[model samples]
Target chain A: MNIIVCVSQVPDTTTKIAVGADGKTIEKNGVKFILNPYDEYAIEEGLQLREKFGGTVTALTVGNDSSKDILRTALAMGADKAVLISDSGNSDTFGIAHSIAEYAKTVVPDLIILGRQSIDYDSFAMASMVGELLSLPSISMVSSWTINGSSITAERDIEGGKEVIEASLPCVISAQKGLNNPRYPKLPDIMKAKSKPIDAVTGASVPARVTTVSMELPQTQRRGIILNDSEHDITELVRLLHEDAKVI
Target chain B: MKIIVLLEPSGNSIKRSSLESITAARALGATSIHGFMYGGDANSAQIAGEYGLSDIAHTPATEYSSTAAATSLAQFAKSESASAIIVAANAAGKEIAPRVAVKLEAGYIPDCVGLALVNGLIQGTRPVYAGKARIAVSATTAMSVYALRPNVFTARKAENATSVNVRTFTPQLSESDTRVKVTNVIRNEGKLDVLEADIIVSGGRGLKGPENFHLVENLADKLSAAVGASRAVVDAGWRPHGEQVGQTGKTVSPNMYVACGISGAVQHLAGMSSSKVIVAINKDKEAPIFKVADYGIVGDVFDVLPVLSQKIGAVTGK
Candidate 1:
């Protein structure tokens, strides 16, 4: 079995993001970039599958030159190969999915895995889009997985429950939280991974189907009324919730 | 313009979120709103007429497959010459809508909180970078699809009763399209999911141990809300991962969010800052959760929780 994993780079969750002057993108200055949190699980799952199934795991990403940092991280985590599809990094989710599908067409790997959703856009649509483009089965938000010969069984999360899905080889699975604990690369492995080869190929350009009109910070108007846990305060809080806030 | 809304089945009726999608289509000034379902009959979907649906399309199916469903929906929309497709951004909708969009060569937008008609096109407002920021976006293609986030759009019943025309058709599906199948469904019995609950009671590390989680559950029971947890509590094996609310966990936007003993991290805030009302209870006055909370109580959870729960229970008569 051969496995392919998709990875992305995103801003650190703690970083304070600001809308750029163009009103369409984030301000990159002073923002710390790291491998997307969920993608770490995808890479880890790929490595574990390859370890058990006796196959090679290839890590793939579509972004500009700076995105190779995540590829290096994947290599450090024991991915056999890393490929960066060099593009302008301004395309929408469809364009990115199209690029990945185009690359997968050439490899025809037995399995493709990705994070459930990118934290940046939070579209949660890539696995389905790529599966459709490749005419393969797709399952999202999978928490547990098992493979027997050519058949695969996965337990995935739904809105209020879990679905036990069955599919065959050459399917797409999106890694959800609690899938597995990712392993950290050691110092020696990190140093060696920096020298690993990354194959960069030009990505085909596709026009964006969606365009951003404007961007702005969420306007919050919290009341910020603070009170102690005294009896009087608790009573007053109940009164406020009943009459003023009317939430109860 | 002809608009098609995907209706998800919940037992014998449609899901509330799917009804909300119909309301969204009505808000788009659609006079001809159609409801489509894969496994239900027209009689089961007659309630859609009360929510401004003029027509209903149904296809019977014994198995579940996302690709086959998308193919059927895309074909139905194209046959009806529909200009827009609306679906609730639930699990099944999130999986099916993108494939339907790709099949129709239409631009798609998911998890929209606001929608409007701008110059005969749909403009959507959605959160980016979690809920830290929001962006106004529009589809460039002639045909468009929008997935409204659950619990945001209010599903209002129409005043006048409108008759619905129901149609059934056989779908075009191949062997490959139905390969991925749902073998079984496991439901969390008698428990409300946090994603669909109007009110949520979430606990954090300050609860100390898993044994004390009864305090959180007791409060949640009084308010008839779902139980939630912070990443720390979930990671500590105090609660299941489905109840965790944070960056890597589930993002929730409830009408009221009550945080008990939680020190809000930026990642945690990103998941729930959009809530309509936020209440934080913590011993530390300087906990970051107070900054975003509409109401803050400074005290220990053990000291404050019982009294607060009793007072709320008395007020609500629960």
Candidate 2:
């Protein structure tokens, strides 16, 4: 089996986001960036698949020089190789998917995996986008999957239930949370991965079909009312929920 | 401009989210709104007419395949000369819309919270950084695809009875296009999923242990709400991952969100800050959940939950 896992870096979820000077992006000066949490599961799943099928797992990403950090983490987690397609354009989901699909064509991997969605954009569109670009079968939000010969069976969540899906090899899958517990990189592997060579290629200059015109913080109109848990307070809260909030 | 709305069938009727997509499409002031679906009869989908849909198209398929559906939907939109396509941001929609956009060479915007027409061009407002920030976006492509977030747009019914023109659409599809298909569906019977629930009662570490989750469940049952959990309790194996609500879990915007014993981490807030009303109960008065909550009660869950449950039951007559 030949597997390719796509990964990316995102601002830590806890970071306080602010509008950038450009007014269309987030401020990066004081924010902390980390490997996207969902991608860790994708990398781990790819490594597990390689272990069971006896093939190589390659980690791929599209970003600038800083994205190499995530590929290093993937290497630490047992990926056989890392590739970075350098691009500076942001807010372009289609452009990024095209870049990854272009890279996957060269390797001709049996399986391609990614996180269900990136935390920053939260579009949840990459797997199907890349699958369409490559003309391959794709599944998203896969929580559990089993491989039998060339056929893959997976379970994914929907609006109120789950669906058991069947697909063939040479497919795309986007990992959802609870898929698996990702393994932590050890100190020795971390040291070895730091020196691993990363193949760099220039990303294709695909123009963004979607563009952000402005950005702002979400305005809060929540009425902050605090009370104690006394019997009187409980009654009052219920009353407010019925009359003021009108939710109950 | 002609707009196409992708519809999903739920047993007999169209899914509420898809109806909301029709509502979103209507907001664009399009010349016409057409409803399309992957596998279902046109008769059962006639209910979409009440939601401002001018026409409905059904293409029957035995199984579910995102690629095949995208291919067919994109082709239908092209044949109709649609300027935009609207779909609900459900699991299947998230998977299919982008592929349709790729095939049509259209710009796709996912999880939009608001939509407007500015100078006769449709623009969208979507949340990024997990609802911490909002951005206004537009399509550079002539054709655009927008996936409206579930539960945000209200599905309004037209005052007058409107007739729908229903038709069966046949598109050219190949074997390779539908290589992936849904073989079986597993339903979590009798449980309200947090993602679609209007009211959710979530428990946290302050509930002490799995044994104490009944308090939360009882409260949820009395209030007719879904049971949810914080990451701490979920990681501690006290609750299932499906019920977890946080950044890494599920994002919800229920009408009322009740957080019990949760400290309201930034990631947790990110998942649910769009909720219409928030209520928090915690022993530590300074827990972060109180800040965003519409109403809060400062007390231990053990002491407060049962009383709250009984009072709610009394009011709801449950």
DockQ per candidate, 2 decimals = 0.80, 0.85
lDDT of 1 at B291: 92
- Give residue B101's error in model 1 in angstroms: 1.1
C-alpha positional error of residue A234 in candidate 2 after TM-score superposition, expressed in Å: 1.2
Write one digit per residue (lDDT tens) for candidate 2, span B231-312. Answer: 9999999999999898888888888999999999988887788788999999999898998999999999999999999998
Q: What is model 2's DockQ versus the real complex? A: 0.85
lDDT of 2 by residue, A148-240 (tens): 999999999987789999999989999998899899999999999999999998888788999998999987787999999899999999999
lDDT of 2 at B194: 97
Q: List where candidate 2 sits over 4 angstroms from the true fold.
A: none
Real interface contacts reproduced by model 2, as a fraction: 0.92
